[model samples]
Target chain A: MAKNKTFEEKMKELEEKVTLLESGEVGLEESIGIITRAAAIIKELEKELDDTEGKLKLLDLKTDEITPLSEDEA
Target chain B: METYSVSQITKKISCLISADTTLSGVAIEGEVSNCTLHSSGHLYFSLKDEKAKINCIMFSRDVRNIDFLPEAGMHIIAYGRVMLYEKTSTCQLQATVLISSGMGILHEKYNRLLKQLEAQGYFDKEVKKPLPTYIKKVAVITSPTGAVIHDIINTIRRRNPTVQIILCPAAVQGSAASGELAERIARINRHNLADVIILARGGGSLEELWPFNEKELADAVYASTLPVISAVGHETDFTISDFVADVRAATPTAAAELVSFPLEHYLAHLSAQRLRIAQATTLRIEAYRQRLKVLKRPAALTQMLAKNITGHRSNLTTLRKQLAKTAETMLIMHRMQLANLQIRLEANDVSSTLAKGYALVKIKDKLLQNKEQAALHEPIDVIFDTFRLKAEIVEIKGETYGEKQNI
Candidate 1:
């Protein structure tokens, strides 16, 4: 659940949970919990996808500093 | 210094030229002129710039390594040692390696570095990190204002807009481009900015793409903590960075695809998982419902009871028939007893006797059989089968043959 984790990490987590649920060994309460977690992860993934903003930031070659390029510049 | 003969002087000059470290193994880049291939498998030529020319020779062994046969006006870079030709008493270079200039020079340099790096295990498959399945952030190192960056940005945006693109601008061509690209890669690594990095450029002449072939850039790609996708030129062109990188894409747009997953793919996968889960849960609940139906118990018991009731109803019908038969038999037995008693009564023939012997008399509710026993007068009753008469004994009779007493 760490914000620093990449989208791939979250996808892996969701996939593992789904696999566990499908194994049929989980109790009813545990399966419900897995479904809840899976739904949450899916919501997060969807939010991330919908929130995509193509923001370009420029890096100063000499100083290694970054400057966000404004939309008007394009 | 001692006075010497001409051969000694020439030999000493050769020694002096060879002894100088800078001249001993020097490299000169220029165009070749008066190129000659001798019968002894030796190549003789003049390496010249506009300002000066130096006589150069390559023996058969080194000549075998040169890809192209040298002709007049072929530019080349020759690496060899300066020595004196004793017969000519002149300084010349003995080239150990000869490479043609321009595209040939770039190709030669690129190949030599590639081989060197390959031998060093820089491009080992074991060292390559797999690209992430879902890249959330990408750091792009390329010239900022070019079709290369534009293609990359547009491709990723069109496919998967969620990926964060951090453009680390650098020179894509010229002498400083390689170092600048390497530096930008290092900077991105230091910041831990992106999940993957893309080193990209548009197609160009080999000279324009030379920077991508630099060892420094290749090493930078190799040293990156994040996985890298190299897209330096058209599909036909391959750079050292392409070989060193974790993944190679034919063009800048392809690199973008390598880093990001298409949104449609993720959506479809998610939908499939959702459907599978729904089906699984439905199946589980239905199975449970079936199990519950079996465990309910009374349903089976009621079926058993209904079966037994059918059996008991037939048993009761048989018992009723047997009871009726026994009752009929008892009635017949009672009737037969009554009939036998009536025959005895008939055999006694009380009515016949009464008819033959006239009347039978009773005095004081008793029948008198002897008149001698009678006292005075008494009322008597006589009965037959059809009628009865009441009477009184009024006379006494002495019974014996002729004795009779009256009172």
Candidate 2:
């Protein structure tokens, strides 16, 4: 009900919507409606994924240096 | 003493022991020895501590409940009845329950501490903080140089390369371990840096793992604002830290997994979801198109009116495209819907998340998300986050689910 859904919650909601549409029980307009809502969820999920991927900064065990390690180095 | 038959004496002793409630349902704690599991599934063992020993018999019915065979040199608490066997005329315990406490005194201490903390509401679900929806940064508290840290890092890296870990090196054993662990946990909370905290160490014996059982670490865990995942020892060893932390992972690697979201797997899942939605829409459209095709097709109808509409057009074949378009226009749902699908079926290039998570309203190309705006079934360009879309206003309803999903 809330827009502040966690990544897990958003993914779960998307799965449920897809399942409902795939069941072939819902009407054409309803399927359209479901897909429209799913698009919004996908946008948020994709954005989150991008944000998560970019957060590659880490703290070393011996040093206090806050180094932004590249993908390979991290 | 009165002279009596052996059977009579044995029966009398049995009756005496049965009548005594304490002997009937007593729990005796000691080292187990001479253990034998009979072919019939019955367990025979002797419980001994220094000076004395007691013969114990756990029947097959009761032995069914036990998971492990009663091996010699295992310390356990046996619960059942103390009685005399009539045939042998020997006093022995008939045990129904056996709880393994391998390390004797240390095990007792662990149990005692566990109960005390549990009673104090240390392990209450209400007190436990929920792990973040997706953890971005995690603080790991473990030995700086060891397999524990490397194992955790590798597990996390393999699952999600993007997850960043802040190493809070602490002694995982000996007297200094508890203080160092407590200090590190406190420090992580103080900085408010990470989404979660992982308290971890490699597996060791009870004594070697004693630091995790100390009250000092528990005090910090209870006070920590950040969610704590305790992975102090192997799956078999559960310390006081495990009980106190928000979650108790079986191992350090498991703890890493709890914090790291599997990035590639979920991205693939999202892609699959998008494809499924598209497929469902395409299937529906195909079905409608099939139904339209089966209908007498506007060709015959248009041929009759072709002379009236296009006076010069002698060729109805060339004008069939216009006729079909006219028929599709009659079904307004098919027209705008096809256009809508065209927009959705395009490349999914989302550049940014909306300033507001999801807008309740949109006008022209810009989103007009506001508390004041009515939640109507109006289509908005929700794909390609920053990109604009063309949408038609439709009848709105309260959120049953989503109103303008597919369309």
Candidate 3:
């Protein structure tokens, strides 16, 4: 299991990495490393968003008593 | 008419006066009349009763010892020897001790003046103007050659050299000095050159300092729009001008010090304020520099763009997966429903019923739905998949029974 990064730390690292890349002063080698780190941060952020969406869906399912009709079936 | 020398006649008159003089100390009680405090500080008055009156005199030294003031119509006890005034050819009481009968005369005058001014609201703190902390230009209404002016100027120069002194030279004593002082005060106020006015005079006898106690000078000081500092006489001495002025200083030097600020202290305070501002500005700039360093990092840019792209791709993939899953679930459910419907349709099909070896019979044109509907002699037609038959039921034989069939 991946250790979850706090929301604040993830946001800060993401912001810093983006600023570094936009400056365009880093060497190509350094750029690749930074980009890889940025990709990993992006994946983490996506996982977080997915987890939040899943939680929201579960909440909706628990709250709603009426079953939703599929379009084709309707 | 004896042949007497000039010295002899004087000696004889002095001897006779001494013999008739009341040598013993006597206490005479009467109201004071024609009270006159001479320039020499001697008090001369008339002690009078309803029936008779006698001349009285108090030496300067004895008058000084008296606690209460002596004025006309004030009842007082006089203790002195009766002597003959050879120059005036009259007899008078040479008093060495005097005391008030009960109330003090000066106290009455003070209380009366207080009431009059209080009614006029002259003593109201609200109406009194605040003295200027730094009297840049001060008008001095005092004798130019007196020590009062010199003391004030020296004190002011010592405290603040920048303060300008305007001298309105006036007489500070004598009968005419009160009018002159009042005029000079009005003149200084008319010029409007000074922020504050100082009325000062050196210490002197009460009669000599009476000019400052005049009502005209007091009113002028009260009416002044500019604030006034009255410094007349010693600390123990007080006059009407002290009551009317905005502030009363005990001495001339004190009045000057009251209006002057120390330049070195003020400069130090200003320098401290400037240093505080400079330090605050430097701190603010350093904070901004730190924030700029934080914002200049290289990793922030790449992270932002990558996050956007990843978010879009992830959302697209999720939607695609959700669509596929939904489509698969719908397909499975439709297949199940189709199979169930097909079974129901086949069970209701007439050909399938005939294939199950069940025939439908009808009597005449009516199809037989029940055996009771067919009469025993009625002609019936049997329906099979390929052919039909007509038959008559001679006897129903109690309706044929078999295992119940499901369609």
Candidate 4:
């Protein structure tokens, strides 16, 4: 089986890349490239968040049927 | 003889016995009585018949193959020479073969010993201590000039070079060896130098390794605070010490290997620990970084605020414009509707009909439209748009001229 990279490792690497890009010390040629890579990582992180949100929504949907009656009806 | 010294007399007696009787091996059968196994690995006992009894002695080397314990009251068949002890001036049997009466006696003795130890809780699993994975220091009790020490040292050095070895030289065989071994073990315990102790020796015949089977040595091993590893004889060789020690290894080399950890295994363990720590730290940093990133995004905040303001202003402006347009359209429509209604009202006006040239004669407020209904000389009102005349119907004129009239 292939080894899996943990969430922390991936996040740390992306954060480091972002820091290097934002430092403004790198040459312009490399800066753009690093920014592009950082943007991709950010997209991946966003997708992960979206997937988690979707799962939570599914859980909510599963339990959405049991609504309470209004005061007037009761 | 009367003039001879004591030494001369003893020497003369010894010579006479040696010359008179020949030393020969013999087999005798009797019940063992007053049996004693000395510390020197020698057997001292008495063989008794119905009417008589004889003393017997078996040296350590001769009794090497006796499988069962030789005890008093057990019937045994013995083979050895009849020798005379000059000091005691008694003849006795020097036994070689001391077989028990039957298997029943040996089995009973084994069960009795096992039961006694079990009752004392010696075989309880809870009393067993776990062996250390890496022994920092190991004390070995064995003969100084034996292959056991050399083998243990070689195996330990090859496997783990850092472990310290302490040699406790003691006799490993013979009768006195058991007491010596127990004493040395106690001494080691008092010093408290080593983390573990290995009672090791090379393979030997059963009788040669009988010292390790002594109950005193077993008790000493059991009572020692330090963990003991017993490696006596070969793989199939088991003794009382083996049962009492914390761990039992088949050979000296195996005992050394069991106590020490290889350097490679340690390095691997350290590496795995480092990886876990590194991964956990990285994850923690990333989690904080992500939170910071969310906080640092000013664009999202500004965009959200601008969107809210724009939406609110647009909604207010749209509401206002719709309200004004609705009011204006309603006013224009209402005005047009009012004008149309006025036109309809004028079309249905009675005054307009009157202005269209219709006239009538009335009696006060009642109009008379039929002239026949008017009586002659009757006073009536003439109604017109401009004039109202009071007149009397003077004549009844019928069929006058071309039109019929009643006036």
Candidate 5:
């Protein structure tokens, strides 16, 4: 469920939930609920970062073919 | 002397040179020697007649104003000012204008064309397009053979590894470079392949760098829908393309930096944000654990209940002790009162009175409590503490006499 949320929304929700849990006024069940939700958000954020991790590439202007760009070739 | 930084001392020396009128714009007549035309289109040379030599730099912009090239051993009067160049901390001449005899016509033509273009609003700031904030791809138009393309590519890849670089090769300088550059720019725009365009070339002499100053390239740059960044020469060089483009970078590498986002910054920020969330959550959980340990109770409901119960348990203990003590005291008080009543009952006992040798009078087995109950001469018996005797009614002195009776 949290994976469907945008990065910004997930981050905002994670912050709010963390703050609520940190306030030390939550009930045991609700603390557990916040922990569960926060875990999901952190997982989603990690996945998003993993998805963004990509190698450099070069796109040929003439043929429009893409290829991985090595350091020496670049 | 007061303590000053290197920059501060250089500023002081520069101020002294500019404030004096003699150093203002004096033309020095000398034979030019050691003339090295730097790739940036600026001439680095020394002007020496016979006695002394002074270094001079005619910047690329002023190079366009000059009629002839400055070579070693040329007799000329260099028109410039002498000032402390802060970067090198040396006094040198910044030559703005150089005039040679018999050839002053080309600079006039260039100036004339520049003024005409300016009048036509080709260099208008209002016409300049703004670059995209998040450029996904960059269309670079330059000669593909040299280090300029490699520099641009390397700079972009270093900043953002995943950004698309669409290399649109065009001749950077020649008789035909201007037309080719304009055509490539229009083609790149037509393909709609990139967010921004970088029109670039390595530094060269003013004549070699003249392709970027042509009107066709300027027109193509001014009419581009996407933003254009012109990187024509080194830091001192400026061309007509530089004015018409939205942004002018000093070098090809700098143009690449302008278009590509720095992935390091975002990645660092992302890592820091993740760390903050993790640390904050960990701290909160640890706080709960510590709270549980200190209070020896659950956080929400049982914590308060346990507190109340402990308080009430102590109070109940104290009340129990107080109640037991009060009950014991009341019991002692009642026992003392009972003992007093028992003593009073024993003191008024008839047997004890009899034990003191007083007799009880009885007739026909009825004991007379007072003399009014007795028949005077009935066969009567008298009882003492431990003895009994038979008697007759000889005398009744107390009954006839006035002894009071509670009858």
Candidate 6:
């Protein structure tokens, strides 16, 4: 799972899956699969959202490189 | 000395003044007097510095460049050349630029650029891009040493810790600030480093915040591929960057709030969705379970069948009684009819008549109704109630012509 996907994208996917499941057309196997995938995405999104470390950084305009900004920098 | 006419003298003086580079490009600071705009769209005025005065003429084309209207007695700076008016026979400064000093000059330049960019459709509402609903990485272009960056970072850190703030250090003021700001914004676009760019600076006077009003920075904000949020100065202060950006924030901290989402809100929304999904699916399955439960109850069906059987059995009993009653009525009716027929047959029966004491007379085997049916010597037979008598005719009696009788 590359974390490159946006939280919005994952949330949208979860919403669509939930709507389909709620339609009641999903069979036992399909329901299990959707639930599993939706749960995984939700968990991943929650973990990323809760993360507070490694937040601020300074961009070197000359070199165009990124370096983490310490607390004092902020 | 050559003796010359007035027109020739004035032409020679104008030529001499125009030929001097210093006089042609001179700037004079003084008080304005006798200022009037002619119908032909030229301004006629005089600039005075107490000791002396000089006539000035500003053409309409150059007059339109200044932001404010010049009034008499106003102190200002005029830039142009000294030229001799041939018709008036007077030397006048052909002032191409006239503006008040300090903020007045910058205001004029800002207004001129604002009009130019507005005509080019840079600040068009339709051209503005929508800010992304979710901004993950925000590039804040401001001076690194300023408190503005710290305020933005700290505000975003408090509001949404998940959002990553990338500070793009750039000069916020001075002559080189606008160029540096434009360069940094271009670099962010080139690398696609962030989801959105925020050009922010703390509040300052119009002169101190002039870099944000620069056309180069305005153009940079407009040309960005990513959406831009301009947070320059306080709420009351507006800059050209604000007009060109996709969103305008009143302050740097406000910019942070605009681009970041609160984690608590997301967590709450996620929980609500999870609850709703589980509830919806459970409700559906529960409905199906109720239907199946109703179907599984056979006792109601069995009771209905029993009720139907009891009704049919009572109906059969009533029908059997009706059939037996009909058959008995028919048997009695037939017996009465047979008895009536027996009486009719008994009325014509000879044996029944014999039982009534009547005799039947016959001549041999023939029955005799009268003596005329008998021959003279024929044998006659008589039948009584219980026996038959056989005899021959010895005599004939009752042979009178009036009546023939068998006695």
**DockQ (Cα-based) for each candidate:** 0.40, 0.25, 0.01, 0.01, 0.23, 0.46
List fnat per candidate, in order.
Answer: 0.55, 0.53, 0.00, 0.00, 0.17, 0.67
The most accurate candidate by TM-score is 6
Go through the candidates in order and give each one's C-alpha lDDT: 0.83, 0.80, 0.72, 0.70, 0.77, 0.86
Q: What is the full ranking by lDDT, best candidate first?
A: 6, 1, 2, 5, 3, 4
Q: What does candidate 2's lDDT look like per residue over B246-327, in tens digits?
A: 9999999899889887888778888999999888889989988987775667786676666687554645766787888888
**Residue ranges of candidate 5 with Cα displaced over 4 Å:** A1-74, B1-67, B70-136, B158-160, B259-263, B279-407
By DockQ, the best candidate is: 6
* B278-337 per-residue lDDT for model 6 (tens digits): 886688779879878776789766765886888889999999999999999999999999
lDDT for B29 in candidate 4 is 82
Candidate 5, which CAPRI tier?
Answer: acceptable
Q: Candidate 4 residues B191-257, lDDT tens each?
A: 6757788999888755567788777887788788888899999999877688778888988889989
Off by over 4 Å in 1: A1-5, A60-67, A71-74, B1-100, B301-407
Estimate the TM-score of every prediction: 0.58, 0.45, 0.50, 0.46, 0.44, 0.59
The clash count for each model shown is 10, 10, 18, 4, 0, 0
- Per-residue lDDT tens digits for candidate 1, residues B281-358, read 777778779878876889766875886897889999999999999999999998999999999898677667887756
What is the TM-score ranking, best to worst?
6, 1, 3, 4, 2, 5
Evaluated on chain A only, model 3 obtains a TM-score of 0.63
lDDT at B281, model 4 = 44
Tens digits of per-residue lDDT for model 3, B22-74: 55467899988889999999988999989999998889989899986777766
Residue ranges of candidate 2 with Cα displaced over 4 Å: A1-74, B1-109, B124-133, B190-192, B205-207, B261-264, B287-407
lDDT string for model 4 (A8-60, tens) is 35456666765564454566567557656655654554443333111100001
Please compute the TM-score of chain B alone for each predicted structure, in the order given.
0.52, 0.44, 0.57, 0.52, 0.45, 0.52
Instruction: State which candidate has the highest lDDT.
Output: 6
